[model samples]
Target: MASTIKPVLPTSYKAAVIEAPGAPLKVIDVTLKKPGPSQVLVKVLACGICHSDAGLQQGHFGPHLFPRVPGHEIVGDVVKIGGGVSRVANGDRVRGTWHGGHDHTCRQCHMGLFQICDNAVSNGISQDGGYAEFVLLRSEAVVRVPKDLDPAQVGPLLCAGVTVFNSIRKMKIEQGNLVAIQGIGGLGHLAIQYANKMGYKVAALSSGSEKRDLALKLGAHEFIDSSQVDPIKALKELGGAALIIATAPNPKSIAPLTGALGAAGKLCVLAPVGQLEINSFDLISKAASVHGWPSGHALDCEDAIDFARTHGVTCLVERFSLDNAQEAMDTMIQNKVRFRSVLVMGSE
Candidate 1:
């Protein structure tokens, strides 16, 4: 299939493009192209700003990765589909996630691990993403979403919301187990609600009392103020966490939580930060382990969306225009967004 094909029409839309490393996002008019075979073209309604976008700005995943439109948590309406596409039709509400496009013939794909395909294409990294008026998506990565839902609110679910919901369901712990979320930020806030709705004993762990009431209001059974006390000792007092989800992107804060894992428990680290310091004996004694999770595929994203919508798991989001894409990304990376930052298009 053809990739990055040019449009016949001249200057059809505007996008927030990263002109170069360390440069601010520039909104410029561009020719919007049609989808290739097995591809879909979407009119973007909203796209969430993720902290991971900083990697694209800082030239981390490089040699030649600039002029890219950085965004992955995309919520939009399908406007066109290329040949060989049968899964969805025009005007359908859909979401494009991080697992942009996958080569289905790879060994990992054969095992149903499309997210880690040998030639996995990541939206916003491997290709232009939803930081624009329109985005082209592989048919396999387009998840059909609810039309009635708010695009700004549901956009994050395609990433942050799904990351937690999908990973938590796949965790070794079962419902009603004590699940602790170690952060009160973007991913952590959603994690609390999902854990509670999924029938777990939810505990929200953070550095201060500011988020204590907010955590309980979001369904956490208890709030562990790590600023006033040791979160590890507190989780241990609650009989140890069956699962501790480290959403805070600091390895130092995450590593010590391993000591609070119960027998055969798991510490699921979601952040891709620095290396974690863990004692082998601590895990060996309890049969516990630390691991990371990549966000799920389109079908899994569908499940996450359905669960959140059905259970009232709403994402708190701050809105920005496509012109302010740089500010949105900056705010997200600086942890200034109350939860998630989304770029809203056409007053949506």
Candidate 2:
């Protein structure tokens, strides 16, 4: 028999760890295990700080194990691969999203709904994530990224990008449809770009006039300042939105926008705000619908990256070092980040 070669692994690495719920993340040394079958070790180059991470830290996503390294929008290079891993190899650049690993035999997985697999492992939530110098990832959760793209810019796409893409794709909105994106923050900015590129007559809906220029710059055909004018009326004047993507986390901000939808219009909530109160009359009269969309699996992330690359869509990011992860998380939580915050490690 030919000799079998085993991949060498690192003994320890640095990580930003949350010791408790509602506590600040601290950098700590952690030991690593060799990649098991179907797993790969990654040297994290950049990791995006998302609102979901804040929610998880604040116990909003339910109970989480302590000392967790919270990050899902991970971009890195594969350092080692375990047995049976075939998707990626050593030295390959890749990205990982919220959908970690899934049991292939599950009904959801069998039906190609891998994002909602009955037994799914969540990166950074259920297990250690990329808020570290290194992370061990399931090969099934990794997607190859183009080497030409900047790692820092690509990190947020793994989560925020794939999320909006999957949601918009599911809507099947036709070209030239009036689509409004509420909130010009991390998710909204990307949604606007995607909506515009996908051939929608895009409208940017935000709280103030300040984002009007930015929204237009991102390809919004029209900007609706919700603070000064009624967004519902403004959108109605534009023939009403055929599809409204609610990216703002505040339910109060979203409830009114529900009325902005035209007949058979759909409101897709990408942000996870609790307990929304929509007028029953709006749904009954206009036949409107409201629903939530979680992030997609790795293949969806690949498609998002490909589309973004082709359309020149990129994230406006504030870079933070691995040591300053606490500040990064704080900036994201306080809504101070312009669009997205990414932790840069190693050379990039």
Candidate 3:
């Protein structure tokens, strides 16, 4: 059985939209639509500007993305709900990540791989997303989040946070094992924290020595400045990096890390910097494997959130207003955002 609820709401709201490929996002007034069956109407609070949003701006990911509202790292309050909505209700705080709605009929869904459904619909990609005052979400894609967490700070966890946490959680890492995190930015910073909290000896790999203190403060046990020394040689000296999570998108920077893996180690690439060129012998010789990860679904997002909350792991973010979305998106893609860029709509 399902119950439907609708509250007093506005007829229209402000939203940031991408009109076409390579175009800057512009704020515009959008008429609101009531939630349909198995759907939710959320009052958008905070949404992070992720680097992958570039895919939306460039019309890359979805079949029809023009006029898209691009934002996957969402934190909002449930305002209304259509039938079949038992997981959450009005006033509940929640976060929605990259895994949008899925068509259960897909083969991937039948295999319980709903996150990567064959059709591959996504928040801020195939659908209108959180870069607005209000948005409609399918109940299947909504995850209830805690009320106490700061919307601006925790929003990025929906995407960037979940990606690293979900990926590292799969490694089944053991204590004292050396785990190297490539890059000290958005995904890498959080990866270091998650890896450290998971009982591994965390090393932060970056181009400069300036990030050393910050990386250490974020729970990295050591800092390897690639500019000063060969990271591969350094990792080899440190008994080989048991797991190397490459968070940078530059293929050139990520490819060489295969040589730094220990016996049967894995290099998990979390960034989307296009084609990578690597020496197959490096992986073959060490029994290492390189692979990429997609952000998890709703239940998985909850797990990532709960772990961060319990472990005191925090997401560092720079805030921007909805009016400044273009600047925020530009700054994020340019890698100038402190770590994550979040658009705050109102008081958290």
Candidate 4:
């Protein structure tokens, strides 16, 4: 059950703050403020380090202010709610989407597209994020977590899971449609599993043979090595992939797969590639569409978690204590973190 007690005495909370770009995070003591009206105070249990954090840290995603705590994949419990906040109660297990709080007055909101709210502020980026003992969120951004889900393992679901879910949902692949997932890493692995559960003929594309067996074991029906042979030709001979999901950062690695998209097929880019140079005439002739789907709304995020639960979708997470956050981040940077990396907090 969620706790509703509002502690009266102000107490210091531990937080990991990135003082500057490329600088190490500093652990600091902070005084957490009580939730104001329309706000809820969450005691963070775990947060997944996403590639977006790498961009924020390297200043690749524009100028993020200093002293920012870069973690958007947050799972926690609502400990307190401000006056008039009724969506969640104290002690509710919860997670927050990228939108910290969205302004419902935008045109997008009227169309039920609040995820693209013009005045939206995001967690860990536009606002203080989850790399702390406590964080504040507007009531609208919180998604109630299933009580049975493990807090640590569910952290990456906020971003990685939702990204793959949203992408696959948009693809509308039939049960036997040929689908290929590029880069069997964090997002790719989950994409492969999700696609398989969605009833698609799943294939995995990677640079090396190392991930070939793992990909097949993770529900991929076939695996292709871009290094050994032309993945486009291989996928073409395999009846061409109807839907290709690119989960790697390098656009060149995934660009060729555009040709592998059979007639009227689709290529979804989940990773933020620097740029994609495509043969427009070829794409137009094949009637292939290139799409990009970022994180979805709070409700969509909930749908993903519920779907995962129903389908037994899970992240193969490597756990690290909160104190080892730096090591965890380093592992993610080196792409050595198997599947996913999550920080575990609270008493076990």
lDDT by residue (77-135, candidate 2, tens digit) is 88888999988888888887788899999899998889899999989998889899899
Q: Candidate 2 vs candidate 4: which has greater lDDT?
A: 2
The RMSD of every model to the true structure, in order and in angstroms, is 3.7, 2.9, 2.4, 1.7
Cα lDDT computed for each candidate against the true fold: 0.88, 0.88, 0.86, 0.84
Error of 2 at 47 (Å): 0.4
Model 4 reaches what TM-score against the true structure? Answer: 0.95
What's model 3's lDDT at 118? 85
Give the TM-score of each candidate. 0.95, 0.95, 0.95, 0.95
Worst 10 residues of 1 by lDDT: 1-10
For 46-100, candidate 1 gives per-residue lDDT tens digits of 9998877888888888849888998898988877789999888877888888899
What's model 4's overall lDDT?
A: 0.84
Give the per-residue lDDT of model 3 (tens digit) for 258-330.
9999998889998878788988998889888887777788888889889999999999999999999998988
Residue 136, candidate 1: C-alpha displacement in angstroms = 0.9
What is the clash count for each candidate, in the order shown? 0, 0, 0, 5
